[model samples]
Target: MKSSNLLGYAMALIGASFFSLKAVLVKLAYLPSEGANVVLAQNELEPITLLALRMGFSVPAYILIGFWAWRKLADKPSFLPVVQAFALGILGYYLCALLDFTGLLYITAQLERILLFTYPIFVVIIGTMFFGGKITRWSVLAILLAYAGIGVIFAGGEIATGANVMLGSVLIIFTAFLFAMFQLFAKGLINQMGSWVFTCTAMTGAAVSILLHFTISASMGEGVAASLDLPPRVIFIGAAIAFFSTIIPSFLVNIAIDKIGSQTTAVLAMIGPITTIIAAIILLGEPFGWVDALGTAITISGIALYTFFERRSQPIRAIPLKT
Candidate 1:
C-alpha cells in the first residue's frame, strides 16, 4: 500500500475505535451513581432528553463544518438538496439515534454495537427490496450466517439474560434498519452535494429535530426539568460523546472513504464491534462469553466476505465526488 493508503487505513482504524467507544461512553452516562462516575446527575436524564443534550453540543460543529465545506464553491448548491438533507437528518440521525439510545436502556453496550453493526446486512436487504437489486448467492449465505451468529450471541451472552432482552434487540434491529435506510438516502446526495456538506447539513437538521423534540417533551411534562437539572459530570460526559464519537469519527471515516474508497472502508468497519466488545468488558463489566466470541467472529467473517465478493461483482469504477 502507498503511504497515503496507509494513512487512510490508520484513519479508518482510529475512526472505528472512537465510534466503538461511543457505546461505552453512553453506557457510562447511563449508569447510576453507585455503578460508576464520581458524581451523580442532579436529575437522571431520560433517553430523549439525553439525546437532545448530545445534539445541543454537536450542532455548532456541524454548522462550522458546513460553512467550511462550501466556502470554496463559486456556485453553491440549491435549496432542494438542503431541504432533502435536513429531512434525512431528522430521519436518520434523530430517529435512529433516539431508538438506539432507548434500546441501550435495555441492552448491553456490546450487544448494541453488534446489532448496530448489522446495518450493512440491512442495507443489502433494503436495497434488494426497494431498489430491485438482485440478491446474490453470497448474500443469501451471508444473511444466514449472520443471523446464526446473532442467535448464538442472543442465546449465550449475559446481556441476553435481561428481562427486556427481546425488546432491546428488536429496538436495536429497528435502529439498524433505519441506519441502513439513512445510508441509501445519502447515496444520491453524497454524490451531488459532497459528503462533508451533506453530512453537516443533515446533522444540522437532526439538531433542529432534536431541539423540537425536546421542546415538545418539556412542554408535555417533567422530562424537561430533569434534562435541565443535569449535573456538570453528566454534561461533561455528553460533551465527550459529542466530540469523540459524533464529530471526530464522522470526519475520519468520511475522509477514509474518500482516500481508500468504500470497499476497504467497509472491511475496516468490522473493527468497530471488536473494539466495542473489549470496551464493554473492561469499562462496563459486561460479560464476554465464548459464544459472544465465536458469534462475533462469524458475523464479521460474513460481513467481510460479502463486502469482498459484492465489490468484486460490481463494475470497477471510482466513486465520484461532488464539487
Candidate 2:
C-alpha cells in the first residue's frame, strides 16, 4: 500500500478503537462518582439524561463545523442538502441515539456494540425490501449468518430470559435499523454536499432535537430536575463520550473512507465489537464467557463476509485502489 493508504488503514483502526470506547464511557457515566471515575455499585443515572449531556457537550462543535464548511464554499450553499441533512439528523442521531443510550442501561456493553454494528446488514435488508435493490443468493446467506450469530449470542446467557435485556436488545436492533434508514435516505446527500458538511449539519440538527427533547421532558414532571442536575463526574464522562467517541471518530472514519474507500474502512471497523468487549471486560467488569467469545467471532465473520460479497455484487465506484 502507498503511504497514504497505510495512513488510512491506521486511521480506520484508531477510529474504530475510539468508537468502541463510546459504550464503555456511556456505561461509566450511568454511575454516580467523582470526575473520570465510575462506580457501578450504584446505577443512578438515566439514559436520556446521559444522552442529553453528550449532545450538550458536542453541539457547539457541530455548529462551528457546519458554519465553517458553509463559509468555505465558493458558491452559495444549496438549500436541499442542508434541509435533507437536518431531517436525517433528527431521524438517526436524535431518535436512534436516544434509543441506543436507553438500551445500554439494560444490556451489556458487549451485546450493545455487536447489535449496533449490524446496521450495514440492516441497510442491505431495507434496500432490498423498499428500494429496487436486488437480493442475491449471498444476501440470503448473509441474513441467515447474521441471525444465527445473534441467536448464539442470545442463547449464551441471561439475555434470553431477562425481560429487560430482551427489551434493550430489541431497542438496539431498532436503533441499528433507524441508522440504516438514515444512511439510505442520505446516500445522495453525502455525494452532493460532501461527507463532512452533511455530517456536521445533520448532527447539529440532532443536537438541537436532543436539547429540545431534554428540556421538554424536564418540564413534564417530577425527577426531572434531579436527572438534569447530574454530578460533575457524569458530565465529564459525557464530554469524553462526545469528543473521543462521537465527534473525533466520526470525522476520522470519514477521512479514512476518503483515503482508502468506505468499504475498506467499514471492514476494518469489524474491530469495534472486539474492542468493546475487551473494554467492557476491563473497565466495567462485565463477564467474558466462552459463549460471548464464540458469538462475537461468528458475528464479526458474518459481517465481514457480507461486506465482501456485497462489494463484489455492486458496481465499482471510482474509489482508487491506492490513495
In terms of lDDT, the best-performing candidate is 1
lDDT of 1 by residue, 1-323 (tens): 69989989998888888878877888888876654434455225577777777888989998998899989656678889889998999988899988888888888888888777777777788888886566789888878887888888877766566888789889989988888888777888878788889889999999999888898988788656654676566678889888888888888888998899877876787788889888898989999888888888887777777777778776222121110
lDDT of 2 by residue, 54-90 (tens): 8888888878987887788666448877888899899
RMSD of 2: 3.9
Please, what is the TM-score per model? 0.92, 0.91
- Candidate 2's C-alpha lDDT? 0.78
Collision count for each candidate, in order: 0, 0
Residue 323 Cα positional deviation in candidate 1, in Å, after optimal superposition: 25
Off by over 4 Å in 2: 32-44, 74-77, 158-163, 222-226, 315-323
